[model samples]
Target: MSAPYVLVLYYSRHGATRSMAQQIARGIEQAGIEARVRTVPPVSTQCEATLPAVPNEGDIYCTEADLKDCAGLALGSPTRFGNMASALKHFVDSTSGLWMSGALIGKPASVFSSTSSLHGGQETTLLSMMLPLMHHGMVIAGIPYSETALLNTQTGGTPYGATHVAGSDSNRPLDEHETTLCQAQGRHLGQLALKLQD
Candidate 1:
């Protein structure tokens, strides 16, 4: 049988959310399971005319089978007016078939997000992402106060999930606290996934 893996699925327009996805993947792998990183193409065009089947670069697009087979999921996106980007939400909406099949039922899932400003709706974005997963019957995971970084982060990091403040130009890389929270959140979800499997 293939090894169990966590799906780190994200939509990143400016690379900040992608970097958070990588950090989360590293933490998932630390739990001795595989991490599969995937991204959804933008929804600017119709389904038939959107991105090519294969991306020109970066992570490959996620398939239904990938989402169906994951033991855990880490969803990331940039904040879009107090919610996840429409592109990511559009992709999530496509997984109705999986939901009907109960493909994600009981799976451990978490969310992360990036924002251009400190108060740019990071928590609301993360919360919005969870609504779909909850409907899928996935067990939601979040960082607890024990993480310490969550306690001290003046920029981003919420019990809702890990988040980043990418600054006005969207150029600010994740600060130390945000990075730590991302990894810690991933580790928490990874451990939960393994435990649920048993």
Candidate 2:
């Protein structure tokens, strides 16, 4: 059988969230666990049509098995009016089967988000992402004050989760503090996953 892993699942529109996912995955790997990265497709205006099973490039779509089997989970999305984007939420909402089966119960989970402005609901979006995981009976994890970047970050770092201020144009790269927080959140969640397994 394969060793356990953390699933880094996210939805990115302009790519900042995707960058954060990569850094979080790096931290999970640092904890000596596999980081399985996955992304969800965008929502179409028409319900009759759907995205292809495989993405054209970048990470492929996340599957229920991916979520069910993960030792831990790191969920990310771009902020949309102080909430997670609809695409990520939609995918998560489809996990009722896992929730009913208690497949995710007891696993540690964390959330992260990127916003277009400094005050663009980074914390709220992170909180919004946590709601579904909570429903799945997963243990919630957050970046602790021990991560000094939470105190020093001028760009993005929060106790709710790791965050990135992507600027109004959605073009700003993640600053050093944002990157540090991402890794820190991932490491904390990964450690929790390892410790909780027993």
TM-score for all models, in order of appearance:
0.97, 0.96
lDDT of 2 by residue, 137-156 (tens): 99999998999988999989
Backbone N/Cα/C clashes per model: 0, 0
Best by lDDT: 1
Clash pairs, candidate 2, are none
Q: Which whole-number lDDT from 0 to 100 does residue 45 have in model 2? A: 80
List the candidate 2 regions with Cα displacement exceeding 4 Å. Answer: 46-50
Task: Record all residue pairs in model 1 with backbone atoms less than 3 Å apart, i.e. clashing.
Answer: none
Off by over 4 Å in 1: none
Per-residue C-alpha lDDT of model 1 across residues 74-143, encoded as one tens digit per residue: 9999999999998899889989999999999999999999999989999899998999999999999999
> What's the C-alpha lDDT at position 19 in model 1?
94
